[model samples]
Target: MLLILSNKKQLLLQAKSLLLSASFQQLSRSSELTFTCHKISAIFKQSRPALFNNLYLAMSTQPAKDHTEGHKIPFLLDDHTVTTVRESKILVILRGLPGSGKSTLAKEIEQKYKENSRLFSADEYNIKPAIRSSDGGEYAKLDEDLNTCCERREANLIVLDDTHHDRERLEELFDFANKYHFIVVILEPKTPWRLDCGQLKDRNHWKLSLEELKNLRPALEKEIIPLYFGWFVTKRDEDALRKTSQDFLEQLGNFKPFKKRLQAYGYEDKHKLDLLKYFGKTPNILHCTTKYCDYGKVTGSEEYAQQEAVKKGYSKAYTLHLTALFVTPRTAGARVELTEEQLSLWPLDAEKEVMPKDAFPRGSRAHITLGTATEVQDVQTGIDLLEFIKLQQAGGEREDMGEICGGRIHYYENGMWMLTLPRKIELKTIFSGYYGKAGVSAPQRGGKKVLLPTCQVM
Candidate 1:
């Protein structure tokens, strides 16, 4: 009986050990699955954020809710939605250094857009990947291919995969986009090690050295070249200015001398001439333009953007005192009296370029264009300002048209009028650059869309 009891105890111990082993294996398997899930989640989060968000909501303990309403996912839009909802043409320009995962991102974008997307890669054209291209032959061919793609309108979305470090190259792409009426979206890789030269050296397909990678870093590190640089007026100030400018226009319309001048300039029905429509609202941020970079296509633009003064002043706020309101047949603007600090960011040759013969001080041509005449471009505003300065310097007869809007009005020949204010109009503004967009629209303010005129400097 004692032997049987001992055997039973041993059997019980063996059963308990087997049960523990089974439990341990099960736990190990669960942990492995959890880790894999996490890895997959991370990848999806990066590649397909919208889809991942939906999946996460579905898998949550709470009830799944559709945050997107009825609109389909960007990648999975139905035929009806594609035809009606989306922009007809889009050019996605992937910009980054080699090994920065630009190509990877391009592939993902192409995959997301599916059959509607077509990718044009410089590598496919046999152009070596570098900050600067040694040969123009392959690049020219690549441009031609892209041009053809744009001409054909073959795809809803066209992806260009390349370093795109050169501003000139980017300008060419912008030109293609403009010609094709395609919305241009520049995308840089979100990889943490994108700018890490050492990592890039190892990861790059070309096996470029650390030195080569470093050489490519400077161009990417520099500030993005803008279509133009200037002081952006605050919304509040802009509204006030708009009202003041409208009032001034009304005052000018009623003034007989101004009417006579308009009549002399072929505006036969001077009384009927709508000055507001004659000088349409410019669709741009109301600011005094400092330099028109033209997206680095202009000579010395890149250098001007890279200046120490420009770098320091960028996005910084400063006060501009508007001393006068001036109007020409081409443009209407308020002259900005730049402080010494503001003058530091002003291009030395800005005024000289427009009036090379005169030795006007820096910032002399600084003016915030309120409006431009029909068919006249914004650049004409600065030229008009210079012309006014030249007339002022030449001691041209000033017909004192008396005070309008609490300012002394002086007519300076050939439909050029100036209003010198009793007190300077002070404006708060931030120094910034304007990159071209699909439309001339400002951020929504007070639940209403604020539209700005397109900066048609180019």
Candidate 2:
């Protein structure tokens, strides 16, 4: 799926709708949250940032803080910087050597807050010098930047990926957290995944040989291994990251009502809604305004007036369907009138509509005299008549999609259009009495039925 990050809703909804209709394997629900991304960064971009910042305050929950698990999840960062955040912040700092599974831990943070957080990566913004391992200055700048971001007062979940060598550098981070009053969790992997650096040498994708690390390994160990000195714990698994983020948010607040508001606005019960609320309340339109405005039923059931189309012993699909098309003049305007015969005989412009010259035709006594207005009938036009009292159900294609010849016209009530179908042949004759040219015909809908409001000059 193409990423359309610019219009979040359009991108997410359309993609979700499309995906729901298809069958796929190896699905990671978070990745499927299809939204197109623009290069521009607003406050809300970067993984439901608004929600993360509000992790501890904005939303309030029922039992207050969730301490059932015995301990509050810790927040930690390795950069020597400080900061504070509001309601729902969950800060995680991952410190380890390059191959010690820091990225994997970072990914777990994203999965934990799948609805509310996104992973911020170091490699993505790694300076050119850092990429080639040629300059220490780039890494220093990056460390400072990461430290500064961790100090933010609005981060929902900030996970830092870096190496710590001593208390001197860690002090820079501790000092900031002290001023900002943000909690820091110290994390260490218990069962780190070990990779055979040598194995990468023989693969088609490898760019180096097994002998290369012999020289570089010393520098890496000096900068990285000392950082894990006494704090080595093997419990920083994927589950650990998830449990930590969830516990942090729960302590911050209960988000159910907020979730309801989002659901009403058609937002999925996820982190997007939590962020959306934090950003500001979004207005909700009537459900019909949605692109696919499908209700249980709209308009009415229009079936052909066919009884014997299907014999008692025959199939139901064979039944003739007659549509009872009831339409109101979207625009009630004036027009000239002319009889059918007069219209046929007149030298009128083909483009302009010519009404009946005579309001009431010779054959019927109950003629609908549309004064100053005209009702022109095509072969598709017909009328339905009910017994006892004559009820007319107009059946045919409307002249214009939303326009009608002017003079006088009907209006629909509360946008509700109803129709009564006839099953037997006698019902067809009853309709002919009121309409004169009575017949059950199939419905002819012009243009697609759109959710946009009906347009009329009046």
Candidate 3:
């Protein structure tokens, strides 16, 4: 076994870490062939159970070999090469009042799926401790995991486990599967996740006051919610609904509706509106829809999203988040007067809107730069451009660049101050937005080839 582990570095390292600290009792529980803490802890002085990656660690807890058919399944992913397995995407939707056992159901689903090698759970992949609900990045991380699994050349199957209560969030996953030519299995509960007032209070873990009870979910059986950002259009007027629907459909087509609203960033409507109202003069402002609820229905937060995810799919997927950008100057104010010697990158072209007409826009935010500058820089430069934002905010309730934040004062290779805000307003990738060389999907080689890189079962 040691000889085999040395040949696979990642697995060996992971195995080594697990083997050293695991309890002897726990070691006996693991299969000899699979990743196990006992196998990994063999080299370590003490078992550092918390140090192991949860997905690998929890699964590794059963440190033993699969001895069947007079054959043993290898201990590592590298060791157990096999025939293809079936994969499909799942969206488990739980709808109910609070204390409907939605979270418990989700866990059961997660345990069931992990038995398969192809399964990946969002909780296992997205959060570090796995069960904790307070982590800040569960949503974005889950999206990343789903994205990675969809793009994997080696993965034959993948499931997006999550709750999808309504069309808004569920549709995104459905659309993603459709784009990749994969099946979407939507699991609706036999009943939504809810219980009668009397029954809910009977549960041992149930906790809620009479005042707080109103906010809890309603009486439904399958307490699950879909795991993506979403919305719903509601109105009493028939003509208004039709008009609103048409307008919304058009907005969706342009990807404008998803911008900055509940679908884009989960934020309060008033704050979003404050941002939206400013765009009247700046038409490039994106039309983002604030998260829509049923007049007063309280929507779930990030934790509910992951629990629902656990129930939604056949297997769970892994997640990662990446944010990087290319710098470009804003073509305004002080930047207009700067010389090429003082500034770098293309001067912001005045003719274009702050954002392209077709692209979805985000609320204009204020950012401040507090570094010593020897000269008044060109607005055409990124710093000058961002400074203009600071100037605009100075006029409103905003005084010091929206909120105080920090980053390095980077100088271009040619010595120009670059002041910019964090990553915001990136457009959602649309199927129609595919642009590559010669109409190819996504040009891998670069010089303008259209290349749409998706997937297929090999």
TM-score of 2: 0.24
What does candidate 2's lDDT look like per residue over 290-372, in tens digits?
00001111121111111122111110001112222222111111122223522332222222112233232322121111111
Candidate 2 structure lDDT: 0.28
lDDT head-to-head 2 vs 3, winner: 3
* Stretches > 4 Å off in candidate 2: 1-90, 114-118, 127-136, 140-152, 163-176, 186-196, 199-458
lDDT of 1 by residue, 1-458 (tens): 67645644554444334333443224234554445446546555776688557645533411111112211223223443233213335566777778777776676667766766889988788667675554555588778777777677677678899887776677667666655545445556646567999878876777889998788788887657777888766545666677777677767877877887775446764556666666765644577889887767788899998798886565455668999888888878998998998899899999877778788878888999888765677788888888888888888788898888877899988889998887888776656666654233221112222344422111
> What's each prediction's TM-score?
0.53, 0.24, 0.24
Cα lDDT, all candidates: 0.68, 0.28, 0.29
1 or 2: which has the higher TM-score? 1
lDDT of 3 by residue, 262-316 (tens): 3222343223222111111110111111111122233433233343322331122
User: Worst ten-residue run, lDDT, model 2?
Assistant: 427-436
Output the lDDT of residue 135, model 1. 51
